[model samples]
Target: MSLAIKPGKADLHWLLGAMLLAMALHFSHFPLWTSALIVLFMAWRLLLQWRQWAMPRLWLLLPITLLGVAGIYLQYRTLFGRDASVALLALMLSLKLMESSTRRDYVILIFAGYFLTVTAFLFDQSLWVGGYLLLPVFGLTACLVGISYPHGVLSNRLRSRLSLTLLLQAAPLMLMLFLLFPRIPGPLWGVPQDAYRAMSGLNDHMQPGDISELSLSGAVAFRVQFQGEIPAQRQLYWRGPVLWQFDGRGWHMAGNDHAVEKLEGLGEAVSYTMTLEPHNRRWLLMLDVPHILPAGTFLTSERQVLAPMPVRTRMRYNGSSHTQYHLAAGLGSRELARALQLPPGGNPRSRALAMAWQRELQTPERIINAALTMFRSQGFFYTLTPPQLGDDAIDDFLFSSKRGFCEHYASSFAYLMRAAGIPARIVTGYQGGETNPVGQYLIVRQSDAHAWVEVWLASRGWVRLDPTAAVAPSRVDSGINTALTDNTLLPILARQDHAWLRKLYLNWDAVNNGWNQWVLGYNQQRQLELLSRITGTTANWQQLMLWLTGSLLLMALLLCALLFRRKRMPIDPAQALYLRYLAKLSRRGIQAGAGEGPLSIQQRAGKLLPQHEAEIARITRLYLALRYGPHAEPHAEPHAERKTMAELRSLIERLDC
Candidate 1:
């Protein structure tokens, strides 16, 4: 007993499985080499168990453990933040497996497994990720239960049932606490900024390849659930960042837009509730030409939605937009100059062509038409992988390659309008979105990212135009899948193209949308709304506390009643006699266990009191006969029971500790 006993074999297996599942949660967070290191360590631990090898000695484990710590520190350059701490936790878990032997070690490993599950949540709080982590949580609990059993004795089915039973029993208490907890606004203050880097979103810059690169991803940018008719696919122009300055290479939002001008409505306004996913950016995308802004957001001069701060979590807000609206009927000298300014010398051929058209056409509208006609008739093809342009990008695209995506089309078109003596700028945002029929909501993905041109005229301050739409209108209607003749550039989900698969995608996305709305998007606003709904009036802290306290008291009373009822259930006659015998022994200075049977008590008393051996032995034999040694008739054991009772009373009165 000097050395701590090794954990049960079944417990080791369960613990190993739980650790691997926890590791899987972080697969995307770590580099391939780090993930490989974790997997190798896990496999080595499993091999040790299979070979029945002894736990690694402290001399070997300590250095390896230190090496893991050093590796994590070097990889992250610090061990003090969210990502580094999670990596350290993962490393410790793998190393701890190598030295796990005693029940205390097993307990520590299981708790580490729980901590790892929570770390996964620290990065992603989506419904599926949360649901997926529950498996490891159940496994860790079952492993703890299995550790209490003899080696190799616990069954998987029994372990699963017991762990699940425990979770089910604890669910009510968990839910009660969740509902009664204080509702706090804003983020929890611990979400890692690094964890959100891989998720792509629109920035304030629009380079040649920016939109094309975004089109490669199919992840949902946001979802729109309309109160009335959903906008047409071709009309679903959700505006985001606006770029006015072109520095010969890219379009950016710097040094152009100064003060935001309020856009006036000319038509009916469309109302919708937008569920925007966290992209760590401030722009709150809205349907093209919004007249009224959602709460907590303002309209930029360039007609872009701007939030007060970066969005770090899922958010839902109500907004009203105008599908057909006139913005800026007139522009100031400063605004006009900003729109018309261009780089000194790039795309000379494109600039020359635009000037020639303007001189010949004699009007802005005609010039626009002429430019559109050229793109439509001239053998210019629409593609994603446009050839790399040189210094004269517009010249190469217009006169040579003649192939590009939305950024190419938008950038070149804006340059043409400016060269034609017309004021114009580049507007970057998402275009069309697929409508999920199941939930009747719009799913706008990254692949829908687009850039269009905005031109100015004396009659109309600014006009929206998509030269890419003129060349490939299907991109606006049927989406990028049908727009590009070469299907290889489509996103993975769009490439599948099977009806059932599409249905499955939409259905699953609908389920996720529901989870996002009710769970991830449940903020302080929603909490107050729920309370108001429940009480049929506006709710306050006093009402919330009263309700919470009353519910908690009711739960406590029910639990107490159940426990008391169980305690009052009947006990067997032999057990009753044994309890009395133990009580009598305690009074005489000798005592049996609280749960000991007459036979076991007799054996212990006989060793200490051989003078009463005859009485003790007789009582033990009669009790065994009456309790377990059965008779055929109902009253056959009555005489034996009477003898056992008399003998037990005589033996107990004479026993001593």
Candidate 2:
């Protein structure tokens, strides 16, 4: 068998590590059965190595491959989508370990590991994930190098060093390609409908207890880095879905028939850049009324910024918003009716209280204040775990329970406003964020998920109101940690006062934001900017390509010079004199025969040149001793090597004279 098929034990170890890491990346995505099969195949391959057992025959392997394919089909009901295809690829690669017959098979496994590393990007593009992916790539390439090594027993450290050197040499070309490549706006082919999963965040619909469920998650929703002065704590409402129509039990987006007006751009615009985490939803959570819409997204008539498709990866966008804005200068009759519409029979007591307030106050603004006052004075408390509500959820929350998160407060407040014949609705979005000093940016977590009410008045147009704010003012200024009675539910970053943890969190976020900006956010626009800066001109795609080609050429020449460069050998005075003495003997008609020993050569030289016999014999002994004596190894006493070399030099000099 060729060296290709006769795998080295070291190469097998390297391949095992690479395969295990690649499989680990897909841990959460794979089913238990699929993971088990891949692991079992790996273990069987290890056993073959350990016990010197022969690999299974092709007949047995072929049926096992078929079974694996059938199993995937049964598990996912298809073999073509992202999830199914990745799982199948992993299984085949792991099985290849057992079928290893030659060096070519090992090469295939190494490359397959690289391909698997790329698949990880389809799920998560965060900095940590990108860094983690480098390990498997490095390991697989090292294995590829180790298998081809002509020497025996290569150390993992040597293999790793060589692989790192290869990657470093290739990095410039890779960087050039990345910088010059044209980025298309969307995928060219169709994607699987279930390729990505929806995450926890505000949706178009919300029930009484919906927002509280999000509070349990500490995962990041988005990050904001302000260009100028950061917006005030109260003004940092990252608005998302606007729900106008309220069913008796829940709130949802407005119907198509309602011609409701959206908030208009008004005062000074605050410019900021936002890096949003993927929620597999179209809505881009912007501050209350976007002043300038991002390039790819469009503003809905109801004032929500939406992308053309679901964001299945990290998205960075530039936005400007005016905190002071006129929301709906005038409301259409149909929109007013929908906002005020409510189920007639349920929550009678809550509706009656709203009616009494409307009768006494005679203005929508005053009625809003009255409801807020009641929320503050009526023993209302904020809690993540609220009591379950029955048929009359609003009445139970307002009169009996009075303990709930923002959703309950916002939901009941909007219901009361409608009951009093006011145009009211609920706005679901993130409320506050923790500031990171290292990055000087704001991090909004899922725990910051909040719901508030907006009511339309005759004079002020539509006004923003938060009944939750009335009960827990700390929620708006200091964030959810202070607002909650049980701060244990808060995320570590939010509650930890330790200096080390705080520093670590901020530093990590800073690095992550930098990666997101330079890597994942690298698009055609950024490419153009980079090219223009490098060429010192207004560079186009053509110029970018030209520069990229030139850079690659330069890198190629440097690599060639390093690879073929010759090393200079140090001069040895003793060896030079010995060569001269041999030349003298050749001139005097005496020479050493092919395969003749050094002692034989010396004896012949002594017979031919009688005048230099003593010097020749002494020189011969010194030469033999220096080259093949007790001090032959360099580690023998340094002083003895110096002494032998000196004596050989003196004997050769006297003979020449």
Candidate 3:
């Protein structure tokens, strides 16, 4: 317990294991050099022990510690943020092992390892990560057991069992706290600004290959659970940002919301709940023409659902959207101008063709059909790896290159519409999702990222037109995989060739979804709902606290009762081993009489079983030492009794009557 008390060899070994496991958990977050440095420090401490080398001097250790701190500061620009602070702790903890010659130092390292284990949750609260961290936790607990059993009365295997038992015993209390404790409003893993690192998703602007680039990643963007049957692939247009202004090469948003003159739902609304991954953006991707918005979210003038705050964490929200709807019947002059705006003096050939269509077909509807006809009949190819475009990207796709992803077709089509006097804008969002048969939920990944065009019409108000569909109808009807011939760029999960692999992935995802919903997603509102279901009424904070206290007290009383009802004296392990040996010998007609010593029994048994005489003698000697020698004394060497008992048990197992 005191600083002067050095940890025994067993304790040191367990401490080393605990430290290494804890540091390995954060390898992904640490810089390569930082990871290497910590590894070196750990290796040095291990060598110092294994080779019996002297510990580094204070003067040398001080400089190394300062250098590590300086390195962390240089890597992160400050030694205070989440990453930097964790890096510092890992370095110091590993360095601490070098001078950990006392029990107090070893204890500090074990506690620090536990702290580091908890930090892993801050980065990822996934079910697998949470489960994996239990290894390091178990290792640290074993270190505590080693320290507690300094005399080594318990073997290593026994200590491991005790450590696991301790963890199992606390599971009920942990569950109680998780269920009844007051819940926080936001994400449990939310931390400082530095912790909200940039995530990959749709940006507000679309360059030539923005959507195509995003399509390469198969990471889940959001998941949808519907009240009834899931929507068809072609109808599942999860709307995101709408871009109105085009600055020559790329499409950008209008950077403001406009008031819709009129809005109406044309069909039955589809009720669904969305679990969106953090994308650090204000836009909440939802189905087209949402009628019921979740709290803290509103529909913009362009019909894009916007959250009040950027989604910096996983969010679950209930939403209802009409697949068919009358969106924005009228547009203000500013909105109209913005929608039709195009860059000056570019793609004259494309502009000329659009004017010809405008002259030939005087209606917006006719012009739209003409554009679709051109894309369908032209040698336009749908692909993930689009060739580079010139400054006039629209013209390059329409007349020159004629090969690009959804962004290319949509951008050129929108440009053609504006030239033909139709107010068309680009709408970028996910186009389709794969239904997880296990959970019966739709998982929309980034590979489903798509771009289409929306043009205003006098009769229909605003109509959605996907030019990519004209070139690659399979994209809308099936998925991105079917739309492209060279599906090599697509992620394996996004492909359809491996049905068995897909099913396996879906089964695992279903389990993860449950973990997310019931564990990480357990917030204040969920807690209250659960309480109402349990108590048949809404339980407030006071009632919850009372229930928690009563349950804890009841558990304590039960434990006390079990403790007091136990036998006064526990059975000796050495005696148990000897009893087993005697029982085996009795099968050979050799039984020990009352008050017979092990020496007399060994002499008689050895003569009768000459073939196993050596084994019988060894077992007897071990049993005698464990039961009657110095090891039998209460204050004798702690390991002597355990070692002898183990040897006797081993010999007894191999003995022939």
Candidate 4:
């Protein structure tokens, strides 16, 4: 009952556990030193409790706290933003545990644990993280219950059961708010700017090893669900940034001119919905020759789709693409100049070969075919681990090493095209995808990263060509796993050897896809659509607010009814008879004292009324035996206790008051 009372041992243990669980969620994101300090502080607090030591004095605590703050600032360069703030919160909570002795401190720690648990979502909102957070939430709720008791002596089983019951009771209210609350346009919370860094995907620059290095990662780039039949692996060329500016060693994206694209679909367009994971880039990797762009996106002069803002979160958009299309057969003079621009001088051998091909073939089509034939017949090896090249990288790959990944082949082929007077550029994007039969969708991973060449001809415009396909046809037909003879570098999910593991992964990914589409992807539009379907007409924000308010009030009333419902205490037959006997004595002005035992009351009654002494003594003896004697023991026969109670009741009924 006293709020200022020191917390009991059980309460302290619960507080420590709740803090541990909350901090565990962030350990992976925290710096190593920060995580180490958190663990050290928690261990010190536990030792203090174990040894029954006093709290650390202010002089001892103040300096350590300052040092911790300085360490955090040094690690993050500032004591602000999402990373630093979360680290400071976690460290301070552990420090708070050192002095958490009172019920007030216990309550503060429990609430702080709740806040810390919610912060984990700011970094990751995946289904696994969301499900794991319930653990800390339950621990904090149980700790709250522990602090409410004066003695804090509740058994762990009982406490856990109570916590589960509370969560279950709150589930309806949570669901109601989630469904009916007015939906917002952006994320539920405002994340810091630093939250978008370190995301994995293709970048603007593509060196010889850029795509090869990215091919080693198994992280999902995007998932596509087709409105019609899924496209073949070779046709699944998801186009990203087009690199027109090639340095001697690397290729970079050109300046965004925002030129209107001229495209004509030659075949039936394949409609599909794309759920792209954030790579902190503006480019939306749509399939090749996308005629219908998603809303809020536009096609560049080179047919690269661009969003207005960098995607900092998982997003879903709808677009249709034609496998066969004519894209920008005609280019402006400026575009033409930029496309043909390359490093002034390098790869002399490569340039000489291209010139010879130009003189011999004299046309773009024949020259391109000659290059492909040479790659196919010249013992060119397609490998993930290509030897490092020197300054003349293109000449080295073509003349000496002849071993490279897709980027190497594409870069060399594009250079040869430019040297031969054909406008050519490198297109970097994903090449192939694996279909998840469970979800009936295509999952394109970073392992499918690829580079190909696009050459412009006089009449046909820019034509898509993949020199890697010429060297290793399986690279496009199957996947990178099948294309590489040595596939040990690939992630287990990307390889085909572990059939059972891949199946399990597919099942899990399918569940995650559903969670992404129906849970995380639920936005303002989804809310409006769902409401319109539920009602006969379209529901606006005002109607949503009204429904939300009404649902909340109704939920409150239901909770109140459940909480305040009356409960009847079971009556004991022996106690009932004893109380009746006492009432009879009270009527005769011979009431027993508050603390009087049955024997004492019987003796007093006998002294006051000698005629009823024998009956009174017998009744008292039978009642005592039935309620508290050997017959009352838990192991005693229930029938015996009932028989004794019946005898006592009969004797009391026979006695006169």
Candidate 2 yields a Cα-based lDDT of 0.83
lDDT (C-alpha) at residue 105 in model 3: 76
Locate the minimum summed-lDDT window of 10 residues in model 1.
1-10
lDDT of 4 by residue, 244-296 (tens): 89888899998878577578889799999999998889899899978789987
Assess each prediction's global lDDT (C-alpha) against the native.
0.81, 0.83, 0.86, 0.88
State the lDDT of candidate 3 residue by residue for 1-657, as single tens digits: 345576666677777787788778789999999999998988888888888888898999999999999999999998876788889999998888888887677777888899988888777778999888888899899888777665544567988999999898788889989998898776566667577774789999999889988999999999999999998889999889989888988898886656743668886999999999998899998898778889878777777889888888788999998888777777788888888898789989999999999999999888888889988997888888878998777787888888999999898999999999999998999998999988999999999999998999977788899999999999999999988898988999999888888989999999999998888778777888888898998879988888889888987887678657867676688778788888988998998999998889989998998999999888877877877889988899888667777778888887767
Better of 2 and 4 by TM-score: 4
lDDT of 2 by residue, 130-246 (tens): 899989988898988888877665788998999999998878778877877677765322247556654566788999778888887888899998998678898989889989777
Q: TM-score-based ranking, best first?
A: 4, 2, 3, 1
TM-score versus the correct structure, for each prediction = 0.85, 0.88, 0.87, 0.90
- Quote the positional error of residue 156 for candidate 1 in Å: 4.9
> lDDT at 59 for candidate 4?
93
Report how far off residue 581 is in candidate 2 (Å): 6.3
* Model 2 misplaced stretches (Cα beyond 4 Å): 1-5, 151-157, 187-191, 255-266, 496-499, 569-654
Query: How do the residues 1-657 of candidate 1 rate in per-residue lDDT, one tens digit apiece?
Result: 212566767788888888889889788888677788888888888888889877788999899888888888898888767788888888888888888878888888898789788888777777799899889999999988777665455788998898998788677777776676567877763455465655578989988999999999888899999998987888888888878888887888855346665466767898999988778898998898876778778777777788888887777998888877677887888988888889888777888898898889989999999888888999888898988999888888888998999999899889999999988888888998888899999988998899998898777667789999989999888888888888787776755367788888889989988988987777777777777999999988788788788888888788678656755568766657656655755665667767767777777777767877776677677557656776324667677656666766666556543
Per-residue lDDT, model 2, residue 94, is 85
